[model samples]
Target: MGAEQNWIPTEIGPADVGAEATPYGLIDHLQRLEDLTGLLTREKALVFRGFGVTPGELDKVFDLLLPNRLAYVHGNSPRTKVGQNLYTSTEYPQEFTISMHNEMSYAHQWPARLAFYCEVAAETGGATPVVDGVRWLAALDPEVREAFAGGVRYLQNLHDGYGFGKSWQQTFETDSREEVEAFLAGTEATWEWKKDGGLRVAQLRPATTRHPVTGTEVWFNQADQWHPAGLGDETAATLASIMPVEDLPQSVTLADGSPIPAEWVEQIRDRGLDEAVNVDWRPGDVLLIDNVLVGHGRRPFTGSRRVLVAMSD
Candidate 1:
């Protein structure tokens, strides 16, 4: 492999891998991945392509990759579930790019791995760009890096049932307030239920973390995604002119409540995209990534694109 291709995923086609283009072929590929011990951890990602894997056979392949298949708890984005623990990626309007970040990095615990399956490839420009966490961290300016030393504060403003942004019911995937309170209690986060049927939460989370296995610290938070500053000048200014930052549906600030400069967050967001290796999808392609070692995002696309994701501990 060429040095330029180092960040691209390790791809295996059915023919080259000597496996038939079917569900069983995916099993063969999974077995091969297992045989090549440390490949997932070393390469950080693997893409199985040209397998002709269908939606009906996806569960079998997913079970092999994510045995436990953890629930998407405390996720901030909107998505529709079409399968067990599998969902359409980030349901953000397709035109906007989803920025890079480690999945659930703000939570008390995060997934160790994430597996993605492409059931329908986009007609144009739909690619899941991935970046090495180490590379991303190195790309940030030292000032921005030091600014986050005390970590970050994440705030979520959930509506009761009718209002802008997600309702507490939809955000937590539950109708029971008791359950939501219990979940937040466990996270050691502050929360309150408003008389108007809204839910407000605030949590302090680290900006960086050491991988459990590799022990290498990496950039690991969604500050860029949560801050209005990173939402593009027009969008950020629009949101700012409408409401105060803390009143936004989702917002982030320094752990001490200091405002994070727009440019600082922009730098972190821009460089990650600049350094990423984009993985264009083909129907039936699956990508497996070590969640802590890599960060992923989406490119603006046109037409239909259905990508299902699952996670493992």
Candidate 2:
């Protein structure tokens, strides 16, 4: 692809629009801009830099960037809710790199837009890498793509109060079993309450999806993230030694209950990362992305990195 077409995220700075390097100036520019959604769709991702927006001023910024911010319900990543419909971006270890995937692609429904704000930049090596989903799909091997043609099944085993992953209450953000059942009633999912006070939920989703506006087909599954083969050999082996595959915190398989090969899993993970463009963090910087068009992940870092995220449909 040409350079213009391959640019995953288009960056904007105060100087680019002749605005002051302040939050109010950024807000004024955003208010005056026409068709913000259309611009986001065309660019896939946008980085708002040199704004000097503080934590106290983030809500106002988010209100414009993410209209009708949604709660992080049914999320698998570890995060802390810090404000109304706002969360700390994945609390995964600082030493481990997260693989690229469209947010919540395995679910029946997902956010259409995501906004991230960097409150504190890491000391070294922490960058949010974004990949064009179209490029990611094109990078995958034909055999691997065909293997997922029929769709994939995602399995989650959430405990009542304590477990390897999240608890059922935490996953659904509710303490009521009736509420959880009500939510699941609307999805194409099956759930079973285990004798050990755990909940096993399974969902089947397509491997690829077309953008609602552009109609561009993109890779849109979390098979690599959910599969044991993508976890690194040491971690996978430790999990295997602890429990059987079925009882693992999370797992995935083909729609027909067939195994996805390890090589395919590795390819999916590697190719997406290989095609990604890293967005290095700076305190007060903000990023807005069309979640369907771009997949995001994190690189290993040192020191403290505090990035907050919010989403909207």
Candidate 3:
């Protein structure tokens, strides 16, 4: 498996780095940062292995990787903040697999880089499967690609402070309606307030984007995560039974106000996973990537696993 995903990073042990995996070692590497920066931009991902970094030294290591960290505002996934800016990876049950997505690709702005640090490794599975955006785009059926050519429409139904799905406060990281409204004004989106104290948001975003420096076209979007069809029939049916489609926590369709066929969504979900390169993790390992150039997902795992993630623009 490792040989097949040769694009994935290989372990860079302490001996290979010629220093212990400590704050000082990180600082020393930064002195010759230009070469590393060029390599990261070209490769899109890297992993620092066997660097026995502790929780207290995470800040120092992260500062080297992400100079100006950004808050996960407007994110839809379930996560818990365990430190100042660091957060636990998606909080889904261990039995389920998390599909691939570029960080905040659905938003008008997104993180340019991200770092994932493993504090504990799972006894089984729990690999971070990644894919080259170029490869993923190639693996898709031509018909599915053409269907999403125009773009996608994303709809989010956020509660005032109760009920299913994340509250508006958690999604926008604010309790004040004024702040939420202010933030939405800056994006290419519109919204309406529901009588039931829910906020219904609608936005049209591109299904693909080009990398800034490399100018590489990548299949970039979160339609799979937003669309009910991507979930199994049983789960999608349950959500539809409970509420109107528009009232669901999240939904998506084509940009021209037409339905996206379930088959299209299923192919997008399946092809991405089929072509992904899974990177099995070890404790104390840190995976860094150029967010737009790569898509990442979580595989099902057993036993305890703690992967802390943070991002920067």
The best candidate by lDDT is 2
lDDT of 1 at 67: 70
Instruction: Rank the candidate models, highest lDDT first.
Output: 2, 1, 3
Q: Candidate 2 residues 234-287, lDDT tens each?
A: 888888899998888899999999988888999999999999999999999999
Question: What is the lDDT of every predicted structure here?
Answer: 0.87, 0.92, 0.85
Instruction: Give one digit per residue, the lDDT tens place, for model 3 in 1-313.
Output: 2222456554555677686676567556655467765777878888887776667778888888887888888999999988767889999999988888999888889999889998899999999998888777877888888888999999999998888999888999888889999999999889988898778889899998999998988889989888887887999999889998777898888889788888888888888898788889987778898898889999999999999999998
| Model 2 misplaced stretches (Cα beyond 4 Å) | 1-5
Which 10 consecutive residues of model 3 have the lowest summed lDDT?
1-10
Tell me the deviation in Å of residue 213 in model 2. Answer: 0.2
In TM-score terms, candidate 1 sits at: 0.95
Off by over 4 Å in 1: 1-6, 31-37
Clash pairs (backbone) in predicted model 1: none
Candidate 1, residue 191: CA error in Å?
A: 0.8
lDDT of 1 by residue, 1-313 (tens): 1332356678877887788888788787786664432777778888888887888888999888887888777788888877788877889988989999899887877889999999888999989999988888888899999999899999999998898788888877899999999888889799988889899999999999888766878789989999998889999999989999888999999999999998998999999999899999999888999898899999999999999999998
User: Listing every candidate in turn, what is its Cα RMSD in Å to the true structure after a full C-alpha superposition?
Assistant: 2.2, 1.1, 2.4
